[model samples]
Target: MSPKNLSALNKTHKLLLNKLKDKRTRQIYNKFEKYLNINENFAVAVSGGPDSLALSFLAKIYSIKNLLNVKYFIIDHKLRNNSTLEAKNVQKQLKKFSINLNILKWNGIKPKKNIQSIARDKRYELLLNETKKFKIKNILLGHHLDDLFENFFIRILRGSGLNGLISLDKKTQNNNINIIRPLLNFEKKDLTYISKFIFGFFVEDPSNEDDKFKRVKIRSFLKKLETEGLDKKKFLLTINNLKFSNETIKFYTKKNLLENTYFSEKKKLIILKESFFHHSAEVIFRSFTDVIKIVGKKYYPVRGKKIDSIIQLINNKSYFKVTLGGCVIKKVNQTVIVSKE
Candidate 1:
């Protein structure tokens, strides 16, 4: 690169950093950085996409300014023919920024169903392996506001419960490794602007435009909604309100769990006695959902019909079992039991 071009790039980088040092970005970064602790050594998952690329750039700046150690990881699922080339390009870009990069490749057999989900699981597995090998505790992702909104709508469309509508958390613990999202408050458009103006980075994945993907369909639907005068700002405000409300409900739900539920560790069974059922059906339903979540099953709010069926089984003369999402709910003498079967 020419000296003049390098100087221009540096000027652009400074401008982009200053642009991101605003109220929203600062608030989000503070929450995220505190969770991941920008002062400590960490690893970032970079997929060479705009979101992750922006995160990588910001992480690099933060690490240098704070005298912290930060590493970059790119997982090659190797599902597509060009995955290797994409991974190599990501490594090349990180090298330009003087960031340490590691590429983890999946060389094993692929699963048969839902390749997207399978690839995501494999990607995280590779990340977990890296964290364990390097003894790194924090992992940063590039999930942005758009992603959260999309997730919220997706869950809603799928009849998900409050937990699903909660969308991506700012911080979570996965297998003892801390996962943090620093860009959740920033819009995808803002990240695109930063990537173009500062880093001169761009990525195009053909799969994103493929209409066969559920996410692509959702994106198109949301875009149409936007054109019909549905403001994303207002939608996000609704999500924020829903998130706060869900937290309050979860607080009570947790209390109910402590007071009403019993777990047989030896049998891996959870029991809810008749005394617990004396409360409102809403509470009972939420408690049931919570139990399912505790056992690592995805929770969807039970419809009135399903809830009625459960109530019938609970009140019946004969033992019966109801199953959903790999969770089994059984009626056992004066009590309702839930367990993984």
Candidate 2:
């Protein structure tokens, strides 16, 4: 490394450390420190929003303190005009702090309907691909408490079951990659403050305010409820209760799979004894979902409704074969067999 470049890097570090002397930044860092304990090199996805920009700073500081390397990436969906320019501007902003932000562009045709959902999936795909290229296992996201609350209400409106209701956790796996959301416990206000204090700006996505999106609608509805004196503390308590119940179901579901199912590694098949269906309905549903995902080799699990239908048919003692989520399932008298379709 050249001495000149090393000097600039030292300046960047000193600047960031100096910012931490600010009481507010220090407080946010302390709260952030309490949550993230990752010692391994990781990646952070930056969206140029307050939450993500704040995440870049906190994560950079974390990597610096732990002496671990971290990569920063942003997805350029190109859904709007001047998005490339915006991405470049964000890249420059991070470069000032010695954090190189890589932009991954979505090149295919964009969906007309379900734009947000497809964009989110593609964003993850792009980020995961970059992580794989770098041989990194974990990626940090900037979903804060507001997103968590909005997600719960959104899932409820979709008539999601127990597992779906609390699916978003601090840590989740997708496509064999670990997704870490370290800011779920922090509110948006704090993240916004950090972003402004550190970067002096953040890009506002217009889609956030557009009511056409379910998440936007839920965000608005939550504000209305807040006006009606809804207590976030109370709402958080409710979510915690639901999470506890979800954990219990997950526990039994694991037990059922361990005790009542056998997998043939060479044949890539799963055999489910009838006892697997004897657990509680939720446990059985969860167990079946896990098995189908494994046998199907799909990143996403099969639709819950379809999985429920298959389970119902198998429990009714029907001898039939059906295909779902790239998996073929059939019952043979006393056992259910699942294999790749």
Candidate 3:
């Protein structure tokens, strides 16, 4: 073999080995690549942050080796004063790597209470719209290990059970689109390293540092705990255990859904038998909430006095109805009919 050919083969071998060495990266890439099932076309969501930027670079490299087609998206929320300039910078960086890019402008009204959440919803909407237009089935995100930890804490504080603590799935479907987070296994710090080393890329969002946001506050709290020599690994382990338990509960819940839930064009209802209701009040509440979710109504579990009230309504003999979080729960004829109010 020619020396140049041998050198090229060696490089290819090294690349393949590197992909296998990291379990998280390997798992995400494999799952996404298979889920996408496309040889040469996909859309990547890049905000030029350390996490997104690193994932973009990896996707670019992977595309070249695997004969995949890649397009990059940068959603300019226009909330920040310098958002346009930042988008331009990101475009320039992506161009240097020969990646095709699009900069989407957000012109919709922003939410009043939680600007971050509004921006996120808009961002995904824009990305999914573009992906659908481009006939791309796979959409990539930049969530990492630190994000999982932060979400775990946020859900815990919000009084969430197993589903919330399980955090996000490596791959999930949204509106017939496959959302994949390839960086879920990597830590934010590792992404930072990759960004600096490979692309000389870094992004600063002022909102991330602001203490007003719940996520920001939780991040700061976690950092303080780290400083205090708290075992983050053990904490995360506990969360993982809870997640596993939650998965088991979810399995049985799905079984119950198959057995008891009924869906129609106008409304969906779950028939909570006395046996199922007596399992665990927490599980029963979650099962009810899940039914509401399927019916396209957003419902959060009521707490304290509200929870007591819900329990009373469930146990009452006569018919009763109460509105909670845009959902109406009615008890009639030994069945609780949960629907949108």
- The prediction achieving the highest lDDT against the true structure is 2
TM-score ranking from best to worst? 2, 3, 1
The top-ranked prediction according to TM-score is: 2
TM-score, cand. 2 vs. native? 0.94
Q: Higher lDDT: candidate 1 or 3? A: 1
Could you tell me which residue pairs clash in candidate 1? none
lDDT of 1 by residue, 1-341 (tens): 99997786577556545745666555544554554555567889988788887788778767755777777898888778998998888788667656667888899898877787778867777887788788898889889988997888787887777767775888766656878887888888767765665467766778899888788888998899989998878887888888898787667777788888898877777888677766666566677666765544332234545656676667664577778545688776777788877
Reference-based TM-score, model 3: 0.74
Alpha carbon lDDT of each predicted model:
0.74, 0.90, 0.72
lDDT of 2 by residue, 1-341 (tens): 89999999988988998989999999999889889887889999999999999999999898888889999999999999889999999999999999999999999788999898778878888888899999999999999888989999888887898777777799888767889999988989999999999999999999998988889989999999999999988888888899998888888898999999999989888999978888778888899999998898665677888988888899786588999988889888988999988
Q: What overall lDDT, based on C-alpha atoms, would model 3 receive against the true structure?
A: 0.72
Off by over 4 Å in 1: 1-41, 111-113, 133-135, 259-290, 293-341
Q: How many clashes does the backbone of model 3 have?
A: 1
Candidate 2 displacement at residue 217 in angstroms: 1.1
In model 2, which regions exceed 4 Å deviation?
Answer: 264-267, 297-300
Provide the lDDT at 44 for model 1: 92
Q: Between prediction 1 and prediction 3, which has the larger TM-score?
A: 3
